[model samples]
Target: MHAAAATAFDATPIGSREAWGWRGRTLSRPVATASGEGWLRLVSAPADKACGKLWEGPQEAERLMPPAVPRPRLRKRLTWTEDEHGYLAELYDEVTAPTVTTHEPILREAPDLNDAWWEGLSTALDAIATVSSDRVAVRQEYLDRAMPQYLGIPIDTTVPAWTTAHGDLHWANLTSPSLSVLDWEGWGVAPAGYDAALLYSYSLLVPDTAAEIRRQLGHILDTPAGRFAELVVITELLQTTTRGDNLGLERALRARLAYLTEG
Candidate 1:
């Protein structure tokens, strides 16, 4: 998103201070959203397939997403300005409550999730799965091509199914208390288990939480396609770690891969 990963919470990207903060504290992370107001995102160009997906992601999500899902509505698409890396910075409005807690390092233990929260999240995902759009993207080829290089090993490139997904389904993008799936910039068609796998990978630091996600999404993740999608997600996080993201998750991710391959 930013010129470098270091620019996440601190950079106050040019032209985006109003959305993020003019005077914020120290931080790291490319995306930033004010609690009750708006958010700014780091993007590249329409030509860059990955950045292009990020740019169109929220708009498409706004159009196709079900009513119950919690997401920041796109109030407007601000003009893109060139960033330090020749990427672009865009801003939009936040829809959900400011009090909601995104599951980063905040949650010391699992929150007691009621049936409604689970149902809403699951139903929202189901609605996304039914959508059909090539404009809203994240193709299967990206995973297939990146896997060998990312994992430092070969893989079975057979993709059995594809569906709409919140491509970056991680702790930071998710909120507890009400189960809101934030950050639609990565929403698009992907291998079936991609979303579940991403959340699973992110939850690896907590065994009980990770087990709960697996149990809840077992129907989707138990299939061959889901397992492969989980592999793709693991490879991605592992790659991110290589660049200094989740340093603690590498060992857990490798263990997961071994378990998956064995199963």
Candidate 2:
């Protein structure tokens, strides 16, 4: 199965042509761009569905950033009516660091991430986690619903503390040499340790990588609350494994689950 690239947009929105050039394709509908002076992104969604700020949730959450953390700064947003979905567009200052998600599908080769980069990512996550918000990360909800269908296993309904999370925290969404997590559309209040769990889940294919994530974020993943969040992440990964998404990590995820649940 061929993965679709965001670069193959059926049409570029009206305002985009005048302001920015396509920087690159992301894994989804939103395309990043170079706006001569700064960077921006083009987000599109169905028209009937009420189009507002492109990547509305992410943009709103970006507003909560503290002085230290690095994130794309949104300058302007424009929406235009279209035949199918409306064009939801936003322009932001470009990120200075290189993205870790350069490879088409999943990252085939790991980038040269160092201690500073990982430390920066951890610090940014810590900052985001301290924030308070009413926004809900809908993608996590959908994934929660799908977990039962995928795992066919009973879930511990014990609720955990919630806080602001980046929603999507894969390597592709993060930069190297410097730390700058990208794609905030999914950021919102989530279960404790949610971000760490998701990152660890994605890293299960690489034992050393997975271990490093656990080592750095162990404070979050070691708590009972963190363990529950990890279970949620495990369920999601197991689903992807069944679909043949991350084949290399299939055995590792199952083994991790066994270790996690054997208690």
lDDT of 1 by residue, 60-101 (tens): 787878776666665544333334323444445543433233
Specify the poorest-scoring 10-residue window by lDDT in model 2.
Answer: 1-10
Task: State residue 250's C-alpha deviation in candidate 2, in Å.
Answer: 3.2
lDDT by residue (tens digit), candidate 2, 120-165: 7788778888887777753456655765675566665455677778
Candidate 1: which stretches are off by over 4 Å? 1-51, 80-108
Candidate 2 structure, TM-score to reference: 0.77
CA deviation > 4 Å runs, candidate 2 = 1-36, 50-54, 104-110, 138-147, 240-244
Q: What is the TM-score of each candidate against the true structure?
A: 0.73, 0.77
